[model samples]
Target: MGGQPPAEPASEEYTVDQLAAKVGMTVRNVRAYAGRGLIPPPRLVGRTGYYGPDHVARLTLVRELLGKGYTLSAVERMMSELPDGALALGVFETLVSPWTPAEPEVITEQQLADRAGIPHDPATIAKLIELGIAERVDDGRLRIPNPDLLRTGLEVIKLGVPLDAIFEMLPKLFEQADQVAKIYVELFRNTVWRQFADAGLPAEGWPEIQRTLENIIPLAGQALVAAFRESMGREIETAAYEELGLPPDEFSSTG
Candidate 1:
């Protein structure tokens, strides 16, 4: 099946042992990732650490990447480049947090063909797998880890954006996003999370830490939206002015 994969079931809180089993990882490996900061520290509830949906998603993604032949050290380095909250949940999820639906759509291979305007394109499907957008499951159905990206790419293609251009641009976009994320994460880490960590991670401080972590997602999103809008507006204004043959000084400062 090459269609939209079914949404994963709602995530549940899991103990360390349960989480390890759920993700098909040995307990030792799970703990190893945690220690390496490849995953977030679990929610501390007394002596037991409880994991959440974010943890499950992160672990699954890590396993998938590893299965695709990424070395553990390479995966760890790539993951380490993500912003703090990003690693804890997922880089994709963090970037698309505002718009992501609670559940992903499920469609048949025929439906996917309809969307692509091709009944069966093995090369195209293979490219999708290479891009990490979709994967073929054990049952033979395709699973799209990031459906938003797939839909967006399809829309852009329909709009005449060449596939090659899209492919060429994705890596550049990811690099820029990662760079920007580091700036914000450093700001928060230095001023907030790092302090909490250095203080022995006292139980009483956990709520504040969690609250700050939760707030960072939306706050960073708002900043990104603002910056993009401002940049776009400037570009549009310049294009419009050039169209009218206006000099720079002919325009009054809008700001």
Candidate 2:
């Protein structure tokens, strides 16, 4: 027998009885563990069952850990935790709807002013076109390019801030929103993908998680909008009238 190689074992599927014997546990206890989800049950094809190496390893660990005084509840809880985003950028990117642009069309400068419900003036419309906030169409007409920008600008104009002062801040806002969006994507990949998976969340479990993100995003966004509306409304009112509180003669009509 010296220098002779040992015989290779034949591949054979293990039955529940054989698996239980291999694990050194009773058949009833093995079945119970499977039912309680301490282990996944064996694959079955028409009443014949087979266990794989993964099952044996997991069962061995479960038995060893339980013997060392670990409770099933503690083990299950440790196995189930999934951590998510801590980044502020994730707030807007994942949850909120993106600004989907509508098709472009031609409209007169008078029409843009009309849409804002303000008196039409060549000076202001020309300013908007010059600043690229309004686009001048081929037919010598103008269109308000972005609705959100148009909306914010209309309010700022109403408050009597000059167009140049307001539009200067816009480029910075846009660049920052884009930068934050990139971070948001990384946050989704890291916290939701890498961290949970590192903690042992099966990728097969994602349907529940997708449903949960859908549920959570709206609630958080709604609460934030509600809180800001209340806080900003009063601050806006008080700021607008800081001059009205002073003597009428002492205050200049334009600041």
Candidate 3:
């Protein structure tokens, strides 16, 4: 008889310290997460505990959720209800990851001023930061989070719109955009996400949920742009008629 049939080779394993290092978490945090039941208890071999890939995936998921602005307690509740934490994490990421990735441009204060056609003053820099158009880095340089937005602002300025006016309009624009985004998000939440959650968040249903979300991503943007174009056309036509002192009926018939 062979000696206990040659001991099976161990799968990938990590001690508590090794697990923390592997997942880029502190040992204390790893223990804390375990205590919170966010991750399953480690396997005890003699007096020592070992963590495997599942723990690594769960910890990685928790970190990602926190980085995405989820509160710890909220993450806890979601983790607690998940049938397969790793798969759930993948679906959650697909749902929340940005549809468009923005590549930021870094420039000095003077360069930013030159591009924006504004003075290189503290007030202007502050305004840029306040409007979220730019951020100041540790090296005293500015970062344009969305260069396309900056280009649009410059184009608007070229149309004889003042920089101050653009700044003033941004807050209102943000509010309107937020409202529109909420409407779309609520539509999905009340329908797809709600149905999935109500069905006990079955593992088999995740793929369908993910597919619906991916489809909606581009469709939502297209629909929003189409609606905005129609509305803007109507508004511009009305304004032009008023400016030229034409009657509504005449404009409607000839516009």
Which of the two, 2 or 3, has more lDDT? 3
Q: Candidate 3 residues 115-234, lDDT tens each? A: 767667888789889889889899989899888888888788778888788889999998999999999999999998898889888878877887887789889989999999988888
Give TM-scores for every candidate, taking all chains together and pairing residue i with residue i.
0.54, 0.38, 0.82
List runs of model 2 lying over 4 Å from the truth.
Answer: 1-106, 115-132, 136-138, 143-145, 179-183, 195-206, 212-255
Which candidate ranks first by TM-score, i.e. highest? 3
What is the lDDT of every predicted structure here? 0.74, 0.62, 0.84
Error of 1 at 212 (Å): 1.6
Among these predicted structures, which one has the highest lDDT?
Answer: 3
Candidate 2: RMSD to truth: 18.5
lDDT of 1 by residue, 27-88 (tens): 99999999988788887755778888777777877786787689999888766654343243
Identify the runs in model 1 with alpha carbons over 4 angstroms from their true place: 1-110, 118-120, 239-255
Clashes of each: 0, 0, 0
Q: In candidate 2, what are the lDDT values of residues 1-255, reduced to their tens digit?
A: 656754332255467888788888888977887777766666775566777665665566556556648898774553234222122122223343333345444677777777666788888777777767788767888766676677777787788786567767767866875775576557666767576567577545555556545665556457656866986776665565673686445644342
Worst 10 residues of 2 by lDDT: 83-92
